[model samples]
Target: MAEITDTALQGTSKSPNTITLQEFNNRIKRLLADPSVMNCWVVAETTDVRINQHCYLQLLEKNPKTGATVAKIKAIIWGNQFRFLNARFKQVTGRDIGNDMKIMVCLSVNYSPQYGLTVVINDINPEFTLGDMERQRQEILNRLTQEGIIGQNKTVPVPPVLQRIAIVSAAGAAGYGDFMKQLTDNKYGVCFYPCLFQATMQGVKTVPTVLAALDKVEQNQHLFDCVVIIRGGGGTEELNSFDNYDLARRVATFPLPVIVGIGHERDITVLDYVAGIRVKTPTAAAEHIILQAANALAHIGDLSNQVVSIARDYIARAKEQLSYYAGNLPIMAQRIIDTNTLRLQNFIQNIPLHVQRRIEGENAQLARQKDAIKNAVAQVKMKETMRLEALGDKIELLSPRKVMARGYTLTTCEGKIMTDAAQLEAGKLVTIHFRDGKVVAGTQSVIKDK
Candidate 1:
C-alpha cells in the first residue's frame, strides 16, 4: 500500500480537497504508521474476544464515573504474538485475557479500506489486569468486613466427623472428581455421603449459578454436615467469578460451615476470606474431611479400649472377693462349733463334782435320796449333750455352701444378686451359681408374683 500525502491528493484531484475511499484509507494508514505511533501502549477494556489462528478483540473505553461506553476500537494479535502474549499473561496474572477484562497492550496502528482501522497488538502487560482485579477483590472484601458478615460462616460449628457433605461444583469437573475420589478412596476406610449441586464454575454465569447451588444446599442443610465449594485448576480469569460480592456474601453467611478449595495454592479469592475453612485444592478439602472422620474413629476406639480395661479390672476384683468369702465360710462355721463344744464340756465336768458333793452330804439322809439325785444328774448330762448336737446340726444347715447343696441356687444380674424377679427384663443376661459351678443365661421372659 502506497502512502498518499496531502500534496499528492491535491495534485491528483480534478476536484479540490477530494480523494477516493482507497486514497483516504491510505492517508490514514500513512499517518498512523509514523515511527512515533508504532508500538504504542494503550489501555482498554476487552469485549467480544475471539480466538482462532489469530486473536481478535473489541477494545473499549468507558467513562469512569458513569460507566458508559465512550470509545471503541478493533484490535488483533497475530498468531505468533498471541501465543507468547497469552502464555506470558497467564503466567504473570494466573489468568487469560477474556471479555470485560481491563488490559494494557503494546500495538502498531494499521488501516485497510475493506477492514478499516485495527490495532495490531504486539505485547500485553499482565500486571495492569492483575492490579485491576486485585482492586476489585479488595473492594469486595472491605464491603464484607464492614457488614460484619465476613466471619459468619466461620462461626458455624463443624461436626467432629463430616460424614455427610453438600458439594458445590460443576458436575464432572476435574476438581469435583478428584475430591470425590480422595474422599471415598481414603485409607482409613471412612464412609462419606456427598450430594452434588451442579453449577457453572467459571465465566459470567459463575456467580449466579454458584449462588443457586448454595441455595439448594441450604434447602437440605440438615442432610449435610458441611458445604464444600471446589473447582479444578483454571486460569485466574476463570477465578474472578469467585471474587464476586454476591457469591462471597452468600458463602459467608451460610448456616453450615463452608469449606472452599476453589484455586491453586496461591490463588485466593474473596470466598476464601469468608469461608469457614479454605484449602489449596480439591484434594486437600477431601483430605481434611477424611482426617476429621479418622480422628473421631480413633477417639472412639480409644474410649472402647478404656471401657474394656475398666470392665476387666472390675471382674478381676469381684472374683478375688468371691474366692476369699468362699474359702473362709467353712473355717468360720467350724470355729463357732468348737467354741460352743468347749463350753458344754466344762459344764459337764463341773456337774460331776457338784453331784459327788451332793451325794456325800445326802448319804446320811437316805440311800433312796442319793439314788434319785444320781439319776437326775445323769439325765441332765444326756439332755445337754443332745442340745449341743442339735445346735451344731442347725448351724451346718444354715451355711451358704450347705444351702446350695440342698437344691438351692444363687442368681445375679449385672453382677448384683437378683433377689426379686422384678429386676429381670425380657432379654437380660444373668449368672446362676450352683455349689459346683456357674452358668450364664439370657432371660426369655420374666414373671413376677403380684
Candidate 2:
C-alpha cells in the first residue's frame, strides 16, 4: 500500500509547477460540480454514520452475492437537507435513517479542499428499499413452501367458535386495545375470553420477543382456542419482524390456529400467508369472531323456524282431518242407531212366543226330572234296607245268648267262670249254669278224667 502511495506521489513530483494538495482538491471540486456529475443517482449501503451538524456516512456498493466491497465513498446529508431526506425516508419506510440500509441517493458531487472527495446526498428514493423488501418476502415464502410448512397453520381447522384466544402484542398497543373493545362490545353479544402475552411488536427485537410470547402460549395451548398476533398501524417497513423467517415459521407451525392482523392494509407479511387467517386490522379480527358466532346462532334460528313451520303444517293437516271426521259424524251416528233400533225391536216382538215355548219345554223337562229322581230314591232306599236286614241276621248269629242256647253252659268256681277243672279245690263250692238255671254243687271228690 505504501509503495502504491509513493508511486502516485512520484507522478505528482514530476510536475514542475507542483500545486498544493488543497489547490488540486479545489480544482477537482470545480470539475465535480458540473451538471452531469451532480444529477446522478447512486445505490449504496450506509456505513459508519456520524451525526452532528451534518450526518456523515461512508457509502459502500458491494457484490450482491459475494458481499465483497466494489466501491466505497464518503457521503453526507448536510444539516439543511438532513431534515427533508430523513423525513422522506421515514415517511416511506417507517424506519429511521440508519446504517446498513440499502439506499438510493441523488448526489451533489463535491470535492472539499480539506476534506477530500465526497458527495452530498441531495435526495433519497424509498422505492428501491420497498422493492428489496418485496423480494425478501418472496424469497422467505418460497423457502417456507419448500420446507412444506407454508400451509401448516392453514391446514389447521378454524373452530366454529373461538371463545378463548391468546394474543401476542405490545401491552399498550392500540391494536390490542381495539381488538378487546370490538369483541367486548360486539353487536352479536358474543363473548370472548382473551389472554395477552405481551411482547415487543416492532423493531429488531420484535421477532424473538413475539416468539417467546408464542412459546408461552404453546405451553398452555389448552387454554386457548386460537392465537392472534396484532400490531398497531405503522409504515410498511415496520412489518419487517412479521416477515422474518423464524417468526413466520413459528407462526406457520404453531399448534393452534393463528390469526394475524399486524401490517396495515394491503401489506402482506410472510406470517400472514402461513397463519390460519389474515385480516386488515385488529378490529377486523374481533369482528370476524363475532360474525362466526352470529352465523351459528342464525343457523339455529333458521332451523327453529323450519321446525315451527313443519309443526304448523302438521297441525293444519290434522285440523283438516278432524273437520272431515266431524262432517260425517251425524250421518254415521244415525246409521248406527237405526241398525241397533231394528235389532232391539225384532228381539222385543219375539219375546212372548219365545217365553211360551220356553215354558212348555221347561215343564216337560221338570216332570221327566221329577220321575227320574223318584225312581233313583226308591232304588237307593230298597238296596240300603236289604243290606241292613242281612247285617242284622249276621249279628244275631254272632250273639253269645244264642251260643248258650245251643247247649254250651258256663260254670264258675265262686264268682269267676272256670274253663278247667283245676279251678276247683276238692272241697270248694261250685256253681253250674245250664241254659235255663244255675245249680249249686260241691267239689267233694277229685277225679282225673283220662
Candidate 3:
C-alpha cells in the first residue's frame, strides 16, 4: 500500500471539515448560474411562492396524486424579466401569477458539488396561467358562497351617482388613472371626490393590503359615498385575493355601497357578487356615471320644455280670448248707437204733428161755444119783446077811453074804480076815477056796473 499522506488519510479531526448552512446556500446559488445541466421545463403545482424585494422567488411544488410534496426549489426572477412576465400574465389573464398557481415553467437547474440544488425561471405559458387563475377563482367562489357573503353585496343599493368614492388599488395603476380621467372628463357635470386608499393590487400581499385599505375607508366613513376596488390590468390570479370570505364580508357590510371595477371580463369574483354594482372595467364604471348624469340632464331638459310649452299654451289661450272680446266690441257699440238713433228719430217724427192736431181740435171747440152764447142772448131778447107787446095790448083793452069808445062808462068810489054798486049805498061823499081823469060827485042815483 502507498504511504498514507496527510491529504489522503482519513482522520476524525478536532474541527469539522463540512461547510456551514449559509455558505452552502451561497454556493448553490452560484452554481445555478451555470448553463449546462440547469436548463429544463417543469410542470408543477406551486404550493408556496415568496417574492423578496430583490425579485427573487422561493418556490415549492407538490404532487397531486399522492398528496405529497416532491420538489422544493429556490428560484429567482430578475427584475426586468419579472416585470415583463407580470405584465404579460396580467394582459392575458387579468391577474398576477403568484402562490397556489399550477404553472409549466422553463427553468435552469442549479447544483453545487459543495452545496445543494435550486431552479431559476426563464419563461412562462399564459394558458396555464389562466388555468391557475380559474382554479383559484372557483375555490374562492366556493368559500364565499359557503360563508354567505356572496349574496349580501348583491343586495346593496347603488346610488345614482357615486360622488364620493373610496378607491382601493395600486397607487399608479393604469386602470386607476383611466377611471379618474374618465370621471373628471364627464360631460354630465358629475363631480367625483376620490379618497385613495392605496394597496398592493397583486401578489401574495394583495389580500392583506387591500383589506387594510378597506378598513381605513371604513374608519373614515364620512369621506366616501361608495367604495371602489379597481385593478386596471392584471392577471386573474391577482383577483383571487378579492375572493377571501373576510374581504367579501367587509365589502358586503360596508356602510356605503361598494362599486368594484376589477377590469376582468372573463369571470366574476366573490367581491363582485358582494358589491352593490359590478363593472367589468374601470372605464366601464366611469361610463355608468356618465350615463346616470346624462339621464338626469335629459329629465331636466324635458321638464324645462314642458314648462315652456305650458306657458306658450296659456299665452295662446289668453290671446284667443282677447281676440274674441275684440271681435264683439264693434257689434256692441253698433247696437247701442242704432237703438239711440231710432229712439231719437221716433221722437222727432211725432212732436210737431201731435202739437198741430191738438191746436186744431181746440179751435173747433171754441167756435161752437161762441155760437151757443150768441143763440142764447138772441132768444132772451126775443122773449122780452113779445111779453112787452102782450102787456101793451092788455093795457089798451082795459083803458077807460077804450071802454067809452066801446059804449061803456067807468064808475068809481073814493078815488077808486067802482066795480060794484053795492059799495055806493047812501054815502056821505064819493069821488070817481076814470082812466084819464077823475070826478067827484054827490050821489043822485045809484048805478051798478054789471
Number of the top TM-score candidate: 1
**Taking the tens digit of each residue's C-alpha lDDT, what string does model 3 give over 315-388?**
99999999998999999899999999999999899999989999999999999999999999999999999999
Question: Per-model C-alpha lDDT, please?
Answer: 0.91, 0.86, 0.76
Error of 3 at 269 (Å): 4.1
Stretch of 10 with least lDDT, candidate 3:
47-56
TM-score of each: 0.66, 0.60, 0.49
- lDDT by residue for model 1 over 124-181, one digit each (tens)? 9999898988999999999999999989999998899998999999887999999999
Error of 2 at 178 (Å): 0.9
Mark the regions of model 2 whose C-alpha exceeds 4 Å error after superposition.
1-41, 47-54, 60-74, 83-96, 107-109, 114-118, 311-450
Better of 2 and 3 by TM-score: 2
Cα miss at 361, model 2 (Å)?
A: 39
Question: Could you give candidate 2's per-residue lDDT for residues 237-292 as a string of tens digits?
Answer: 57776888999899989999999987678667888889989898998888888888
